[model samples]
Target: MGGLSPAKRLYQTIIHQYSRTINCNSSNHLAQRLIQEPISRIKTTLDSETVNKSGDENLEFSWDSLLTCVHHHSPPKAQLVLEWRLEKLLKEKEKNENLYSDLIHLCGKIHDPQTAMRVFTSMESNHGGKPSSNVLDALISAHLSSNNMVTALSIFETMQNSDDYKPTAHTYNLFISAFANLGNSKAMLAWYSAKIASGFLADLDAYGALILGSVKLKRFEDAEKFYGEMLEARIKPNAVVLHSMLVGFCEQKDLVKIRGFLKGVLEHKWRIDGYMAEKLIGFYCELKLVEEMEWVLVALTETNHNQDLDTVSQIHNGLIRFYAKLDRLDDMEYSVGRMLKQGASFRSHKDVENVLCSYFRAGAYDRLDVFLEFIKDSHELARSSYELLVAGYRRAGLCEKVDLVIKDLETQRKE
Candidate 1:
């Protein structure tokens, strides 16, 4: 009777152990078993079976099947399987470049630099294969993943010295991102400068990282320079890049720059998401620039057709509050109406009070009555409106209207 093939035997062993652990209701134990047992035993069992059956030194273990079997496990365990398989393959004198790359990447994923370097060395010494760019990337990424910038940079420098391996854009981006993560703008800029000197045009991602790193280091001038370079390179700035610039401008209170950038953004038809729009509006509001605020709000609302209800509400709320502050009652009323039309509610009593005061000061009693009627069902807003009206009536010695507002307030409270 023929026993199961080595691959099938490994699969059945995994399944039986998994089922056994599951039946015992110990999922953690099952996980431990999955991670610890199968790959460890697979090599020994297959080796013994192969020797006993066919006296064939080459084991028929399937790398694809092994990878598939361990695909669902955590990176560490998957890495373990790959390591075991690689060790066995090396013993069998099998030289697979792809397998070497796969194991290096697996080690990188787990940030296992020690193991990754071992795999790199083994690929050279044991398999007699020159390290490809893919393997080098994996090794560098492993160091980056571990946040070991020194070692990563060392490896990168080694790659630069290699006659055969030229670092890709991805390699430079990883270095840039790693420096940015460290908040070392100088180091990041150095990398960018090196990349430019290498005749590599900075991609949008690289530009963005430099812009953001400059902003982080409070080098707003450098950030602007990078942004200008990006534009000159004809790489269109996305919302993220533009927003970072906007925030940097706002931080410096450079309204002139902000207005210019916003004009270009609007003219270019860049997709302005709600958060960025809201931030720009907030800046305009803080600067007390009503026209700019209104223009940005209208442009963003028109452009962002997919704006969610909450974002719309926030937009209207900002407009209403700003208009109320400027005593622009008509604009406030328009914003409120727009908000209502968009299925958003105004809940700011302070804004409602300001609107009522504006209406009273302007002697728009008829409009006030209509506005009151519109918000009559809103208990808190109506109460605030009535109180403001009552206060105004009392100050003007209109005792009759004061009594009337007080009576309406009492009636609403009762209801």
Candidate 2:
């Protein structure tokens, strides 16, 4: 076994081990042990024996085990293992499409597009093998992974010109996704149009990328247009895409469009998630659309029974903060009550500060006293709250009240 090449030695070791195990144990037990054995251990064992081995030997290598290591281990080591295997395969004049594809994909995974391209080039010239579409796709994907869009597109063009390969919807989606991630709306749309012209209908992922890219570019109208096209094509928008569109509308501050779009969503009985509901309430409050805000809040409270507690607390705090800013103490108190009913602690320091300031600014001493008492009973008053109260009293020429607040703060700090 030591006289044999590393690949042959590895094969012999596996065969001997398997034969010995099978003879002593039941087949089921042997199968279970093999299934439970970690691929990492196997790869490590092979790596320890194979390192420094020459590729002059024409022994067969287990590509599957090597590929597994390439995916799950360090890229540099995996690449070395792959290169070693490729050299052996080449020396034996064996052509394996899967091995070449995995090599290209690993290069991409490691962001080594140069090595990936070299592997691709050598597949035909050095290995005398025709590159399949899958291999080309891997090469293109590798370039895209590195954000080398120019090289990726060049390879894609090459693939298109080749008689043996044609780009799939997946390939086009990668371009759209890359451009979208770069926030290049123009390029993304151009590619989208090209995809459509190539007689391939845009999939859900393609539409999502286009919608997001348009939104990032502040092209709300175009985003809506793409959404409409999605609807017409009967391609349902997922929660993520819908939220992106809503966010785009909010950014554009087109209240009419948001209202109409939301109305349509409700009319069509589309699912409105907690995040979307929160955004709607926030935007409505920002626009001072009290009626719309109230409607949405009511619907959200009713529908979001099973929603996350943190999100519900955030929505309540948002409403309280908004109402406090407008000096609507009654509405603010109402929101606070709702928040408390949900078993949420009043934790937003900003909202507490805003309400306190609003009361002091409006000379509503009675309301301010009530709020202070409430905070005291709830034990939610921090040292910062006392400081803010003292500042407010001092600003209002209430020197005695300021002194009292300072004393209270000192007592609380000691406690």
Candidate 3:
């Protein structure tokens, strides 16, 4: 076993275990013993056995839990155990229902999906155990998580062709969400329409997901149409639906549309959270609507002085960038000063710091000076401040400051 490959070792271990457990002359006694022990005890005993054998603390016997654990566990070691056990089962070719049920459960438990797929495939190839829709569902889920939508789709389509294997709305919903995330509105809509035609009532979440996908695809009209149909179907739009609509408007850069959406949200008496406000502010910034951006920023600050710093930092950097591009030194100074006064958060964001560093490097030196003055001794600038300070002095033609920074940098390097 020591000289064998990990896969071979795993195979041997699984074979040895299966032989010891299943190949007894007292098969009835083993069954009685299993029945005597509660399922919980059986599970705990199985887990303990695996842990002791593998000496891997994270190895779990439950299929789903084991998937996550074995993923981060040693792959070769886990794969060996899985392959060996599956191979031994295949070699047995027994009609023992208990053994088959255990193998099916183990098929689900195997962490490496490729290994699971192989075992399932092998069951179809050599073993007489039938592949169930649950097996297909597992494969689809694993592939989708890996962003292998094509493989998921193939499994789905294959499952659909089997007259005995009718997919439920849950199945279609899974595919819809997957396609929507990939920005494939056409496929999402197709599945959505198919669900409708099949006389399945679309859940609010499903409609919301499809509408959101439409928004991402820039099909605002389609999204609006869907919303109308949703209302006609007597389904109330949830906060998620409204947020997706707002996002759609933002994507279109249609401030008027977004205003209308926001007005509707207000009419519905929904409170704005940081995410929605951030989206609205981001929309204005994207369109370079500086006045609108300022208004939104001030409104947010007044409404909640302790609002999220990440959003404020985003709004601040957007203005800094706008000013830098337009060469509006006065506006830049005003924005930086306002930020300092408001105690804006997100001065700590990596992108914000990079933008500030760029501003200094590009001889927006006055703006850089203001930012450094404001951020100094602040927690935000504790990191990379030395580098920016060095860059700043180099740009300002301060040879003494540059030399001191360079010497300090070298000393830190050695340490």
Residue-level error in angstroms, candidate 3, position 41: 31
Candidate 3, run of 10 with poorest lDDT: 22-31
Tens-digit per-residue lDDT, 300-334, candidate 2 = 56665445566556666777778889988898878
Model 1: per-residue Cα lDDT at residue 29:
32
Comparison by lDDT, 2 against 3, better one: 2
Please estimate how well model 3 matches the true structure, expressed as its whole-model Cα lDDT.
Answer: 0.61
For model 1, the stretches where C-alpha displacement exceeds 4 angstroms are 1-131, 285-291, 301-314, 321-331, 340-415
How far is 44's C-alpha from truth in model 3 (Å)? 21
Task: Quantify all predictions' global Cα lDDT against the true fold.
Answer: 0.70, 0.70, 0.61
Please give the lDDT score at residue 14 for candidate 3.
34
* Residue 34's lDDT in candidate 2: 32
* TM per candidate: 0.55, 0.60, 0.54
Better of 1 and 3 by TM-score: 1
- Selected candidate, larger lDDT, 1 vs 3: 1
Best-fitting candidate, scored by TM-score: 2
Look at candidate 3 and tell me the lDDT of residue 190.
88
